[model samples]
Target: MVFLVCLIFCFLAPALEAQVAVRDTVLTVRPGDSLLAIAHRLLRYSTEYTAGELVDRIKRENGLQGDAIQMGQLLDVSLSYAELLDQPVIRGTNFAARGIYITAALAGSRRMLTLADALVAAGGNTVVFDVKDRYGNLGYASSVPLALEIGAGQRAPIAQPAKMLDALHRRNIHVVARLTCFYDARLARQRPDFVPFSREGPGLWSERGKSNWVDPSLPQVQEYLLAIVREVAELGVDEIQLDYVRFPTEGNLADAVFAFDPAVVPKDRIITDFVTEVERVLEPMGVLLSADIFGVAAWGREADRRTIGQHLPDLLPHLDAVSPMLYPSHFEDGFERIDRPVDYPYYFLLQGCQRLQKLATEHDVLVRPWIQSFDYRVTDFDSLYVTEQLHGAEDGGARGWLLWNPASLYEIGFAAIKGFTDSTAATVPVKLRFPKSLGMDLTRPTSVAD
Candidate 1:
């Protein structure tokens, strides 16, 4: 199939290439400059090019053989300043995305229809649902060969993915397939050679004692992930957002062992190479790719990033956007010297956004944080509480924000964004209906009154 596309692209290549203006701006390399550093320094949030993309252009133009750049060396950048800030819309939405997270369970349920209506009515244009969840389960039936080989699709939660896509796509929602790449219990159990290990045993690397990760260092694991990505892209989803794309974050990290390529490739490189390959393969499919990273990752913490194998700069070259899980409740008490980070969502989130934007924007990548929507730190989380975090994200210059509600509950969330409704007068539909054409079980208790 890809071969056919390549053949067509080759024939139309000249005409397609003609559409690009191919602008250039020159810069002299400074003392501390490398190709990557230059890319980060000059690249901006623009549809014209990603930082790595422009850097690639610079290399091609300058006829460079390696990453080596000396001080006073002249380089030509293919993007102008104006082009750097221009945000071209994808599926009719800007990089400044406003959306929410829906779990695999709720995605397959009837509630999503009403929730979809509520989201659309609330002026949100984007929605992200699960395709593959953290538990190593395929949320929907996958055309990927490996998924079927391993029985990952057995008793799938989302039986009618095409139908669900139709329902959501009809509402003009930008659907992103959320796939957990490395944190897969199913994949680990089925392919023990693909999982992390230690002297302790199979479950040596885990979060909270649940070590079910498919090691990123394994080439076999990457192949499986690529297959899943290709299948998801074919599902007509707008974007692919990888969750848990990092290494195991919990339990006996010091003793954990990788079955392949250990002590050779750096953790960050492993993650970057994996994501880079996924992006390379899927870009032709017209699906945008993004990865969820730890909130501290945006700050470029060496230890933090190395631990998770997700360095913001390394990932920037390969993704459409990077979403940091900035749930304030997840932070520690001594975070940034704030004794109680939970009590100060605004402080931590705002700070996180500031640093994150600095790191992400330089690479021509955008930051869309997963802000706290569910009650965790605030026992009395109200509209104002949620509002503060939302505003903080905006104030810190986040391109967009996505609200995370684990149980699919969003009462305070809705109340907080009441003004988003187009009509001032209160009105609600008596019953919400899913598209019967999708062949879903229509019998569902309604909570989201349209």
Candidate 2:
């Protein structure tokens, strides 16, 4: 019997390695210990499930139909790996995830450690790395069958992702792995059937001089994206952020043919369902999920939401946080009746964050806007300009903010944050606080106007 048990344990070890165990403990019902209290204590920092949900689970586990428990009665309780990992960093009591964006190449290079230090010195504690990009290349080696079969891991940059994650965790830095969905050039090229067909031409439809995007409504595409998320979450990322999760807005959109008819299924539903499915799969793994949207989503325009397949009302409820790329340069002149909107960095971010935060609050989600760090329109773009945007976001009640520079050159941003931290710390303690609890509610307004 001992020999048989040993063989069985060895056989199941590899399979069990991929699964997160439900940590179970037996506890005696003590004086003043209510079921709700116990659930909250077990899942205080957990973003995956609520106290009520856990209460129900506990009742089910012990086969008790009633919430009442007798003193001295023993019960078995469980906590998830996700709950265990959801913790506040040592940087501050209130953990606001002030973060910077890093590309896969930078994340894989030796300079990544130096960049992490620079971020910390700037009073930032989060790093968002693009694990899968528009080109459909995985930054690290992947074992996902579809990714391997399609050569998505051909240019694996971060050879040992686990080691890198361990290094970042040691530094108290939150890691958000960004995966570019839908707009995948590599997947579209190798799997032409997944991409949109051209009504006006013979070839697959693509953004003009740009990449081809997969159809979000397709089950295969959704499963493939979820597979990537599962693989990344398994590698121990703190969060998984989806970029370009929406439908394509550029190119000859009128001439493109998707797998499903937009008139029947509607683009918004397709996008929302995909996000919901991702959340369902990721929540159990103990990792938070987020998505990046066009800055215009904050404006609450129905036409734009329909065009891009990202309705804040539909999307926000499913995400732990929503990152709107609120870059001033991306806005055109005369937006919000302000001429040369790019010139007024503070005004743009303040307005955008105020609108987004209000809507996100209704859905029990966090608003973490992406601020522009690169110079584009403003001639005197410098540290002061970055500082102004940061001020606006904070003033507008954003939980945290991320700096965006495509090339990863953020010296201006670094200086801006450091200056703010130094100046603010002299007067009062400055701490960025991450949300204590996050919940998903499907009962949001159908539209922003509603």
State each model's CA lDDT, in order. Answer: 0.70, 0.78
In terms of TM-score, how similar is model 2 to the real structure? 0.74
Write the residue-wise lDDT of candidate 1 on 184-297 in tens digits. Answer: 888877777786767666445555566587778888899999888888887778899988888877777876778555467778888888898989878888788888888877
Report clash pairs, candidate 1: 429-450
Q: What does the lDDT come to for candidate 2?
A: 0.78
TM-score on alpha carbons, each prediction:
0.71, 0.74
Note the clash tally of each candidate: 1, 4
For residue 128, give model 2's deviation from the true position in Å: 0.3
Clashing pairs in 2: 82-286, 95-434, 96-432, 96-434
State residue 206's C-alpha deviation in candidate 1, in Å.
5.7
